[model samples]
Target: MPNKTLRVERVTKRYGALTAVNQLTLTIRAGEVFALLGPNGAGKTTTLEMIEGLRQPDEGRVWWGDVDLAQKPAYARQRFGVQLQNSEFFELLTVRETLELFHSLYRQRLAVPDLIVRLDLAEKQHARVGSLSGGQRQRLALACALVNDPEIVFLDEPSAGLDPQARQNLWAVIRQLQAEGRTVVLTTHYMEEAAALADRVAIVDHGTILDEGTVDELIHRHTPSAVLELSREVGRDVASALSSVQRVDIQADALLLVTDQLEKTLIELVNWANDHQRPLTGLKTRQATLEDVFLTLTGRSLRE
Candidate 1:
């Protein structure tokens, strides 16, 4: 396959009074693992569908290199592999049979036996799809997507509803896909999955692109501070008086102090606690993370 860049240029989608996706623009590099991350109705899937040729955008254009994807959807389809959130197969069919059925849909495809082995499905080759575990079913979905062997692979919430071990196993497969130089576009609510697999990430919320960059870049750009968690709530005035503290937020049961100077903040906090004869119970310091960046941008957790 020729090296190609996928571009979503000022795209917008609407359903009645609701705008599912706003005027969003993004560029995905070839052979890079890119993740669209947000809450359930953040338009991540809508944007993915537009780029995958599964859905049409109300406005704007999607381009694969210089070719317009909206104008040449059939050609785009030939080069894109899509695995939706729920991929249904004939439950009675064996894993190998399921793969064979999907493989027949395209002229260009991978060998079934080899694909099964690559996806770690060799052990369940003869097992009926109905009898497979959640993880096995997910692997089968991935295998079917790969049967086409397209240049770009689109996965929507690939690890949802999976156990810890199963999620880890699926993550390894995604990493392998990146290693093989396939451009991968995945939408997920799992923060760790995005942090672990994506070369770059776009944080989407309320039908708009909130931010986009490497994990570290996003965290640094949005929240370049350490978080100090206090056992009890601290008044705004008290927290603001601390050295290097940028802000203070009160959670349900704890106080979150954002500071750039961790050492000075700790020393001040300890001194304040000692002077007040109050225990600094459950105090901890941690560097800002992707979750922090998301919360800073949206004021809500990704699972919300």
Candidate 2:
């Protein structure tokens, strides 16, 4: 880990009466991947903008090492590269030409040819920006962000519109950036993306940090080691009495039993169903995941 830490101190942002980001504070170790995981309109983008120097915080500071970024925004612009959620480029510019244009903006830049090859856009070098597919355009966006060879990269939903394979490819590319010792910060609504890529995750909701930690730590904190689903609803009283079950999440069409001992709990449920002469229908078992963590914390689904 790098000795210097990137810090966001007591940041707050508001628009008239609506506060987008509350007094949020967190720190990132150099060369690690950190993610602000939340649903849309949960202040993830607003928080990122303040840290990126695209927007100033209403009352807070962003610090890099010992330097206060709020007082020296230009330094951040120079050392940090950003790939916005919506990146627009000249329709007629070729992939190579676009990289060249971005490279011209920075004093120190990488070789455009090497960047194109690195981003897997070697064959698409001659293709027009207007004609590229969604995945290709996203790769090009990442390529533009790297023209200056920044120390830190901020990606805003890097794989938003990509297909499954493209998303997987993008995830691999992000891992490569970490391997190169570049710090990566991203804002995402996808739990899988955060779980798949982030070293530490901050669960955000209503413009606040509900919880923050490693995926396992967060899940373990909630004590739901496994989730069991049933086709029928077991009344709250009956479900809560199940063996080794930590909690019961009752849904309209199904009942979810959150238990610590998966095998023992399933056996107890089966015996109970058999005693009542009621079949255990539509049963499903899954290990506790970040989605469960989010729901347990907020009383709502991550996608909702």
TM-score of each: 0.93, 0.93
User: lDDT (0-100) at residue 28 of candidate 1?
Assistant: 97
- Cα deviation at 105, candidate 1, in Å, is 0.7
True-structure Cα RMSD, model 2: 2.1
Candidate 2's residue-wise lDDT over 1-304, tens digit each? 3456899999999999999999989898899899999989989999889999988899989899999998898887877889999898998999899999999988867899999998899999999999999999999999999888888999998989899999999999899999989899998989899999999999989888999999889989975668998876445666788868888875567788888789998888888888888777778998888988888988877776
Candidate 1 runs further than 4 Å off: 232-243, 250-254
Estimate every model's Cα lDDT from 0 to 1. Answer: 0.89, 0.88
State the displacement of the C-alpha of residue 273, model 2, in Å, after optimal TM-score superposition: 2.1
**In candidate 2, what residue range of length 10 has the lowest lDDT sum?**
230-239
Q: Cα lDDT for residue 178, model 1?
A: 78
Model 2, runs deviating above 4 Å: 1-3, 232-244, 250-254
